[model samples]
Target chain A: MDLAILGAGAVGRSVADLADDYGHRVVALADSTHAAVAEEGIEADAALGRKEAGDPLGSHEPEAVFDAPYDALVEATPTTLGDAEPGFSHVERALADDRHVVLANKGPVAERYDELRELEAASAGSVRFEATVGGAIPVLSTIEDCTPESVTAVRGVLNGTANFILTRMAAEGLDYDHVLAEAQDLGVAEADPTFDVDGTDAALKFVILANVLGGGGFSLADATVDGIQDVPGSALELASEDGRTIRLIGEATREGVRVGPRLVPENGALAVTGTRNIVQIETREAGSLHNSGRGAGGPETATAVLADVGRLD
Target chain B: MDLAILGAGAVGRSVADLADDYGHRVVALADSTHAAVAEEGIEADAALGRKEAGDPLGSHEPEAVFDAPYDALVEATPTTLGDAEPGFSHVERALADDRHVVLANKGPVAERYDELRELEAASAGSVRFEATVGGAIPVLSTIEDCTPESVTAVRGVLNGTANFILTRMAAEGLDYDHVLAEAQDLGVAEADPTFDVDGTDAALKFVILANVLGGGGFSLADATVDGIQDVPGSALELASEDGRTIRLIGEATREGVRVGPRLVPENGALAVTGTRNIVQIETREAGSLHNSGRGAGGPETATAVLADVGRLD
Candidate 1:
């Protein structure tokens, strides 16, 4: 497969670096402004080195990547809300060109799914976003294999930042601010951790899950979300006493999506510690299936994008 | 797809009972001795009712199912080791007839995987055994989606009986024998609990996983097996004291398969309670992915078999 990766972030660069290992070639690599396009294959190291040195990846503009001959366009740009612009437009441009799309960006899938599906239906290409939910844990693909109709619901701890804070607070008997600061210090939580800590990130993932289950007609605005911002140390201590712990869990069914700090069994599968994330998929026939792992990371998310790419044709 | 189910067990009967719900037809149903065949569709309830009443499922001989018109042969018979007979021959017959095979039986998949693959390679039909490893958990399909080549290792607690016993022992400070007896009384463990408690059952499942990961060449004999029978209640107490618990954990890599009582964090994903099962798939690029759910049940396993049938073009 020939990949045109749009974004020079960790996931995009990793995809460029490892595409060859997966028997794929990167034909185009782009950031916000500059792009490096090669018919055979891009000099990935040089482009990435230039990216590291704070210069243009190549002489071409980012839009030039669309002209490159590529089998799939990997959308790894930073996610945006509502209109899901740039990412949504990138997908629109890819599908318009009859090129398959593999998304590492969550915005289009979460906030503009029906439009995305409409675009997919009109185009010869298909859109896949396994990286948009649960990182490389294969949540969407698992639901796909079981057929989304048979899946009753999906629930889990999807935000590693919030989960890290909650897990640390419970283990160390610290308050939210203290743990959040500690997580920031460890680089586990972003400098601006609004989305991760405020439930928008997890909600977006669950909204995507809801769309997959219900088949379009879902977006972030429909979800009911509650973050762990106010979950105090005493709350964790109380939950611990009751053999439970509070996790910022998200649940998505066909009818709705909800993300909140919920109590889960302390020694149960849902109370995963540290930066780990777990997704519990409830099926009509198979009961509940829980998939857990690192739900965030450049390489981890890149593997999911490549896996989605592998699925296309 | 028209199904010819060759077993009157819980899984087979449930497959027949629910085939209509999944938009499929059961044209033939059989046990070890009797068969029911109808080109249109069999009265599944009648055949199952007869079996429940301590009578033959049908009037025809079991071999007659082979002559029935069906798209797939569902092997839901009891799992047997060594030659994996009857089931192995049945699968061979189906593949020879260019009919897809969905297996609930672990024998052919775990012990005779090479022969099964050889038969599949020569025939137009494809063999899928999703129910063989994790019952309804979608373990094999997840690995298939991830591409087994990229999956480095698979680890988890696979046997429900063993897990139930271990959980009760830890919770109630009960000995292995007491828990085993309780499990048998509760119908969680079979009358002959040797396989479940001695790790033979979990080993069979892991051997099947190894075959999937390595593309054949594994059996129960290739695995290092240890059961929970010798794991005293004192061991559970000690593990609990350290915020850990003993589980009948199995790990399957391309190199080998191992199943034994191992300590996992008390609140870890692997410490699933009661009769639940979990599988941790370690991918080279994606890190570890854990899937937990009901490992065994009639309807649950039937869902997996039907899901496999759904995948057969």
Candidate 2:
């Protein structure tokens, strides 16, 4: 299948790697500065070389995406100024041309499920964004198939960066700032990781999930979010004393949703250590199905996109 | 869809109840001694009442199943002695006629994935058994979709009877006999719960999951099985002191497989407390993804079966 990936950053390269592995031809890759088209598909290793050399592969337009036919468009761009900035138009253009969209880009999906739904209806196109929410967890696909049962509750650590920092604080006795600094140095968190640390990243992902599970476009305004920034250092110690751990839990239930750093009893399945992320989706039928692994990172998100591609062909 | 439930056992009723809720017409029921068929559909509630009141749904006959023109057949009878058992022939007969089979009965599928696979190919039928293992955690469905990715490892607490016993043994420092008594009393363990406690139950489920994930059947003998009966009470205390819990982890890796108890660190996702059963499927793409929840009983398994039906439809 011919594919075009928007954004040649970490997520874009990751998708490119999976596409190359699966032997799918990537037709286009667009970054902030330029768009590159390669009918034969860009190699993942070569793309990595370009990134290391301070020049990304999508820095020049190759013109193949415009001329060559493609089946799907994988959106991997970063979130712009507000949420619906340039990425929205990139997705709109692709969807308008009847391309099936598999999104790892959060900005377009997080803000415009409604607009995209309309585009999908207009063109009778398919849009799968399993990577938009739960990395490789398969939460969206399950919810999509199990509709009307209604996933009444969903709770988990949605952001790997905040989870990494919190896990470090609880396990290694590192303070918030110390752990945050360590995370930044290790490239686990952004230089300004406010979206992850303050729970906005998780909240956006949660909104997308809620929409799928609840059977509609649930806006950010409809959900409640709480960040880990206010969690006191002493709370971690107190949890440790009581054989517990403090993990940032983003929970949405029928009896009102809640997102915060929860003092979980250590015996729970989600009491994961290190950088592992866990998501639990509770439906009327499956009760609570808890899934845990990597919640974020370019490679993990790319793996999810590849999973989507696998399901496609 | 017109459905025929071929047993009045716990599994049969579970499937019937859920299928009825989804508005599927369950037209027939068969037990070892009797069979009931109805055009308007055998009401699940009425059948349950008959079973509770000491009536056997009425005298099994060979022609009863053949007479019904149902869309799907739910085989829920006990495992017959071998391949020539009544349930096996019954399932084969149903599939021979092109009926989709949602098997809640392990006896048939455990002994015959290939036979059933052939039958499915011959008749172009669909076979789903989400309740066969881990109630409705969607293990089979998850593994089915995980075909493109190489499943490196399949590990988790597969037996609720063993897990419940182990949890009691780990948390309260109880002996095997004492925990067994508690599990039986609470309906967590059967009167003849030897299959579950001795790890054979988990072994069969492990083989089934391996088959779906890897596209080939794995023998029960291929797995190194160990039961919870040998775990001493003092071992739990010793492990707990170091912040750990003992769980009967059924694991299958590409190199080899082992189905036995493991002393997991307290922070391990598989170190689930209470009667909750957790399974971790390690794939080439998604690194160990852990799913945990209630693994046994009527309601939970029923929920999963219903979800599968919903997805399949």
Candidate 3:
């Protein structure tokens, strides 16, 4: 299999490394500055070295990279759903050439799920974004494999950094500010964690899933957006005293969409704490499937992208 | 799609109901006693009536049901492994007839995975059993999606009843006898819970997974099996005091298989309390996908069967 990754960030490099290790020809790797085209598989270690060295991407060029001959595209660019000039141009180019997409970035789907659906349908069932929601959770494929018609709801913690912070606050009586600072220091939280802290990241994910479940376009604005920013310290303490924990729960029901911080039973699956992001999907046939793991991070998201590509190819 | 549900047990009846609701014609439903053939589609509500009226099978004769035409066969009899018995016979007949199979019983695979694999291969890619473990958890399907290569290891709490008893004993500081009696009375444990408490049930599940992951055959004896029966009360208490829980974990590795009781951190994904079952699969590409959900009981298992039939059809 010939693969091209349209980003040199953590997720993109991880996918390249795994694919190259498994003997797949990683033909191209790209970043905002430039892109590298290699018919004889890109060296993942070298790509990492280039990033660490902070060398200008003079030897690489984006136009040639996008024009490279590859069977699939692993899109791991930084999320651009909330912005205009996102990575969709590169993805659109790849899809137009009939290259199947395994996406971790929430840009294309969250911004335009319906248009992408049309593109996928036109291409004969080739595009998948299993990594957009739960890292390596498999919730997307599970819902797709089960009853497609009766998926009445998708709910649970969809953001890892926020959930990790909330878990710390709820369990150890730590302030949210302290936990957020620690998470950023550890690289779990981005320097500007607005999307995750304000629930926009989860809303983007919910939009993608709601489209898949309903087979129709859903606007992020239609969701009842709330975030962990306003969850009171007293509420967390009360929940802890009651043997429960507060998790930033995102849910979509027939009644409508609901996202925010909420109290869950201490022993519930969502309380599988730490950096794990757990999700609970309620379907008509499969009542509820809960998945938990390293819900966020470069390695986990990259693994999901590789799985999606491997499954399709 | 036409569905032929063999065995009117909890799972089969549930599948028939769901398929019929989805406009798939359930042409046949059979039991050990008799069979029901309805070409136009059986009324699920009426079927339930007959089942509850001491005729749990609903006025169906076995011969007539088997003779009916159908597109897919859902074999969901009670699990009795390693025997050329009813479940295997049903699957064999389905395979011989060139019908797709969505199996929910372990007997067919446990007794004859190779023979069944050959039969399926002969007929082409038409048979699947995603509902075999972690009811509605999608562990098998996720692993299949994760990689085309063989899986390296699969470990989890496969048997919900054993885990439930162990969890209850640990939480309530009760003896084995007390917990067993409570579990049986609550209908979580079988009246004769040998298959669950003796590790035989988990071993059977691991054998099936090993076959899928390794493309080879294995027996129950090949697994290093242990159960929660010997968990000393003091040990569980000590683990609990240290914020951990005792779980009966079954693991399949390249070296061998291990099924025994182990201590997991209280907040660990596998430490999911109550009836929830969690599975961790280590694969070549996707490092680990942790699946957790309700693993036992009638509704969860029935939903699993429905999910399998829904996908296969």
Top of the candidates by DockQ: 1
Clashing pairs in 1: none
Stretches of model 1 off by over 4 angstroms after superposition = B54-56
| lDDT of candidate 3 over B119-229, digit per residue (tens) | 888874377777677777787777766653636898898888898888888888998989999999998898999889988888878877877776757656577888778
For model 3 chain B, the run of ten residues with the poorest summed lDDT: B304-313
Which candidate do you rate higher for lDDT, 2 or 3?
Answer: 3
Q: In terms of TM-score, which candidate is strongest?
A: 1
Using TM-score, rank the candidates from best to worst: 1, 2, 3
DockQ of each: 0.61, 0.47, 0.44
Off by over 4 Å in 2: A20-27, A33-67, A80-83, A145-148, A254-257, B20-27, B33-42, B56-63, B79-84, B310-313
Q: Evaluate model 1 with DockQ and give the value.
A: 0.61
CAPRI quality level assigned to candidate 2 from its DockQ score: acceptable
| Candidate 3 segments whose C-alpha is farther than 4 A from its true place | A20-27, A36-71, A82-85, A89-99, A122-125, A168-178, A228-239, A310-313, B21-23, B38-69, B148-152, B171-174, B229-242, B265-267, B282-288, B309-313
Q: How close is candidate 1 to the true structure, as a TM-score?
A: 0.94
Overall lDDT per candidate, in order of appearance: 0.91, 0.73, 0.76
Q: C-alpha displacement of A172 in model 1, angstroms?
A: 2.5
